[model samples]
Target: MEKPRTIPSVFTPQWLPLGSLVLLLVTLALALTGCAAEKKWQYLPATRGEERSIYVIAHGWHAGIALPAEELGDELGFVREYLRPGRYYEFGWGEAEFYQADKITPAIFLKAVFWKNPSVMHVFSMPAEPAQQFPGADMVELKLSATGVKHLKDSLRTSFKLDAAHRPHPLKGGAHGEYRFFTAQGYYLITHTCNTWTAKVLASGGVPMDTVFTLRSGGVMRQAKDARKEYLKLRPDRAEQEGMQ
Candidate 1:
């Protein structure tokens, strides 16, 4: 009698083959890139009366730091003498042409996305609070300690391309007189975008940031909110006990 042949089970586990592994990696890469493309904002301590606040603001697809104009100018040294008396100063880093362009064109978009252009740092002196300065904009406010302020100042200092005299290399044209442009330290690319620059500043300021894989503003803001919440939870009396020194 002939013995019956049995069919192999289809549910058996198979090794993650090379093709599958590669596909997984590619998927993860794409997902990460997409996430990075979105805008984000965040801040520490939280807004309070009279105490200075550092605001991370989102202007459409762009991100920037809205700092107290006086403190920033004083601490940064580079901008100290240049900054006019203002309530706040907004700083943004991006491709020169794209940043200054009246509107985004195909050429500007292509160059900015592909990292085919040099970068610029835009400094806007505001006579009002950031929210008042840029109405209808998205913002995250953080109340930082003196140490945090120093970290932010140091970070801003390094982001500039200064001359031998330690002055920023200014661009001739900008949004306006109060709004000036300077040479930036790095090239702008999809991987290292404006939001990514903001994230670096926040991380340098001692605000916890997942800098390694964070390429989006949303990511930075998310981490900032989480950190802020955790801090407040740990010290429920933070507001009452600590002064904004």
Candidate 2:
């Protein structure tokens, strides 16, 4: 009897070396240019708050929150020790590989979405005001009660993943000298992005936020705009500062 021919299994292991050039030009288009083509809000100067305030800042496809470093309670000294002395602290969470990569690639992005990748919390020390530190970013200034501040800080502490020794796991230095990326508590998924994390952080402090659909930086900023209007409505002085009736 003639032996049966075995089907080749090697064909299944595709060489991802040619993900785009081989096929799916339109899919490649969506993967490559979609992020850049999305709308990005420009930075607008907000009248500085005389009291405690939180800033929701959007930088292109990412979103982060800013708070005065000195204002944080001693409970956050774990994070503070890793950062440089600065006026403001900006914190955000994202996929480890994609966030730290000097350049984001389609493979990196797809893997982040498809795989259960580890997350990271990026803390950047800003020497000046957030507006000055990131001239091109979009910002929304929010004023909160003492309770709100406490809740927000507590939520921030929750983002950092503690080690067996009860300390935040330091990953690597940021692209600049003033930043540190620590191992974070959550996994990055297709639906839950860095912007989603910002939404969750803002919502924890009782900000008027809708986190469900805030998958993009643009969406997070739209909610920020809404929060600004809502907070201004409550403060006649701030409304007047904005020249609002």
| Candidate 2 ranges beyond 4 A from true positions | 1-51
lDDT of 1 by residue, 1-245 (tens): 11211211111112235455436533543477333223233334343442356888766456678787667755565664455556677777877777766555555555766555788887776777776666666577776766677778888878889888777887744333566778889887767777678877877776666555555556666666665655565456664565464
Whole-model lDDT per candidate: 0.63, 0.69
Tell me the TM-score of model 1.
Answer: 0.72
Name the best candidate (by lDDT): 2
Best by TM-score: 2
Q: Could you give candidate 2's per-residue lDDT for residues 146-169 as a string of tens digits?
A: 667677788888998987877998
TM-score of each: 0.72, 0.76
Separate clash counts for every candidate: 5, 0
Clashes of 1: 5
